[model samples]
Target: FLRAIGKARLITPLRSEGGHRRYSRYQLRIAARARELVDQGTPIEAACRIVVLEDQLEEAQRINAEYRRAAEQADPPPAD
Candidate 1:
């Protein structure tokens, strides 16, 4: 599974001094999602793309939430 995703360029784990590839928590999380997709009969390539898009969407949502909070603070709602 690791080799599959690495070949697809999804998650690239770092090489250790002993020449062993080491995966971080972040990378593991992505790999887990890909594995789930693969288990459900999705192709590896498509699964990787889905994982990447999901991450992008999550980041966008986080940024939008911050902007919303800022806007609300800048202009409070009028008294009811």
Candidate 2:
């Protein structure tokens, strides 16, 4: 799939006798974000921009808070 999309260049290649591919954490993050954006109806170029330039820290925090609240609202563990 990566090769099909021409995103293989976004990843780093490992240097071996035959030159293998090795992706870094940053590359993986970019690919994941790209996939997410693509799933959300964003074009590849726009998705790359959002993933690379958009400040999503606040949104991430909000989502985390929502999840925490939901978890707290769930029933507690029963007595042993």
Candidate 3:
């Protein structure tokens, strides 16, 4: 099933010199979520799409938080 996911272009695991697929921690996490969705009756393709969107949202949130922190540091509120 992981091969299917990789074929779907959802998460591409690295190919080792020995031709084995190597998954990263992040990729494994994605695969776990996809499996969970499948267990809940979600179609594999849809599950992959949902997982990708979820990851994108998480990254966006993290970047937004960093920007907010940087702005706050650059312009500390005026001391009363």
Question: What's the candidate order when arranged by decreasing TM-score?
Answer: 1, 3, 2
Provide the global lDDT of candidate 1 against the true structure. 0.98
lDDT of 2 by residue, 1-80 (tens): 34523453443445567776566676667688778888989877677667655546657888999998888779655779
Which candidate model has the greater TM-score, 2 or 3? Answer: 3
Off by over 4 Å in 2: 1-15, 55-80
Looking at model 1, residue 11 earns an lDDT score of: 92
**Model 3 Cα shift for residue 76 (angstroms):** 1.1
User: Model 3, range 35-69, lDDT digits (tens) per residue?
Assistant: 99999999999999999999999999999999999
Best model per lDDT: 1
What is the lDDT for 58 in model 1?
A: 99
Candidate 2 global CA lDDT score: 0.66
Query: Can you list the residue pairs that collide in candidate 2?
Result: none
Which predicted model would earn the best TM-score?
A: 1
Q: TM-scores for all candidates?
A: 0.94, 0.48, 0.91
- Candidate 3: clashing pairs of residues: none
User: Better model by lDDT, 2 or 3?
Assistant: 3
